[model samples]
Structure formats: C-alpha cells, structure tokens
Target: MPIGVVKTERSIVGVACLIHKDWTLRDEKIMVVNLNIGSELLCLVIANGPNENERAEIQDEFYEALQRELDKVKGKFILLGDLNGR
Candidate 1:
C-alpha cells in the first residue's frame, strides 16, 4: 500500500522528513511527515496496515513499525489512514 499528504499553498512552513527512505517503511506501507505549522510542530502519519487476510506475523510487524514511528514523535501529532483491521 502507498501513502501521501496534500497541503494547501504555504500551509506547511517546513517539512522535516524530506528523504523518503528515512521516513517510509521499506515496503512503503507507512509514511511519516513532521510538519512545521506556525510555531508548533506536528507529526503526521499515514499508514496502511496488513488486512485481516494477511499473515499474523506480517500484521504484528506492521504494528511494531507503526509504534516505532509514534515513539519518535515528541509533540502534537495526527495519525490517519487505513489500518486494515476489523
């Protein structure tokens, strides 16, 4: 699965994750965006997790990876996307 973010003109003051390789999982299932909004910092995460049909191990790995990203965020954040879980 792929992920992305769309922002209005001049809405984002700066992008902290410029390198895709550093912010996204190897399978491209998760995308982390650290945005500079005015005087505040926001961590925006878009994730596509393994569906119910997928192997349990794969699902576990996805959640673990997601947790790792969340742990790295220090301030205000928003996580929105298809987790693929029931």
Candidate 2:
C-alpha cells in the first residue's frame, strides 16, 4: 500500500496503495488522493480489483477512514471514491 499525499494552494490530492491483482500478486493497483480547496476538503480514490467482494470491503473501510478524517478536520470536506459497491 503506497500512500502518497499532495498539498496545493487551496487543495491537496494524491494516490495510494497500488495493489496488483494477480495469481502471483503481479498486477494490481490502488490509488487514493486528498484535496483541500480553501476551507473545503476532498478525497478521490482509484482502485483496481478483479474481486468485487474484496473491492467492496476495501472501499467501505476507505470511506470510513475518510469520513473520520474529515470529521476531525476543521473545515468542510467531501469524499469521493469508486467503491464499486453499486
């Protein structure tokens, strides 16, 4: 899980956890990015998965974490991700 963070003048975004999906763990990738624009915060996560169940689980957890972080922050925040739950 490679988590990367970036900060901007009014926003921050980055990617994390490039897990490859393969029989031998050879080709899977996951990305997470956080953005802070002015007094607002946003997060975007991109994940690769050949397993829908696992993907859903991971996405759920990720969203929870994002919400938790946003709650602790002192500003408006928005979280976005392809949970693939739908």
Candidate 3:
C-alpha cells in the first residue's frame, strides 16, 4: 500500500505518514491518508512492494494526490510521509 498526507496550521505545521514494503514474489500496493482539521495535522501512509515497477507507480501516484490535497490548505503547512517508492 502507498499513501501520502499534508497538514496546515496557523503558526505551525505538522505532517505524518507511513510506508510498508514486502519482499515476496507478488506485488501489492496500499495507500492511506488522514486529515485532522481540528488538530491541524495531516497523516499519510504508503505500503508497496515486490518490485521496483510497483514502487515507482506508487510514488508517482502518491505525489500527484499529495500535491492536489496540499492545494486546498492555507498558511504554514507540513508535508510528511513514508513513500516506499523504491
């Protein structure tokens, strides 16, 4: 699985995310994200594996989605995540 998230705040920024990769023969991808408006925090997660092709695709898709989400926020922002795009 692959995921990415971003957060924004008035004076501070907080971003969080995760990524998991497998070492098996088969390939799989998983992605997740969480946005906490009250806490002013964004969480992202990325889990991918088995090969480089799948990793690259996950990374590409993640960035695309991440950027789109970031555009909706304002003020100081933080972007963080573990994108297993290896």
Whose lDDT is greatest here?
Answer: 1
What are the Cα lDDT values of the candidates?
0.67, 0.41, 0.40
Candidate 1 lDDT by residue in tens digits, 1-86: 22233344332222233444435433456777767779998878877677788898988998998898888889998987778744
Pairs in clash, predicted candidate 3? 1-29, 1-30, 1-47, 2-30, 2-31, 2-46, 2-47, 3-45, 3-46, 17-44
State, as a TM-score between 0 and 1, how close model 2 is to the true structure.
0.31
Question: Model 2: which ten-residue window has the lowest total lDDT?
Answer: 21-30
Error of 1 at 61 (Å): 0.3
TM-score of 3: 0.34
Model 1 stretches with alpha carbons more than 4 Å out: 1-27
What tens-digit string does per-residue lDDT give for candidate 2 at 16-65? 33333311111123344455557665544443332365666765765566
Residue 43 in candidate 1, Cα distance off native in Å: 0.6
- Provide the clash count, candidate 3: 10
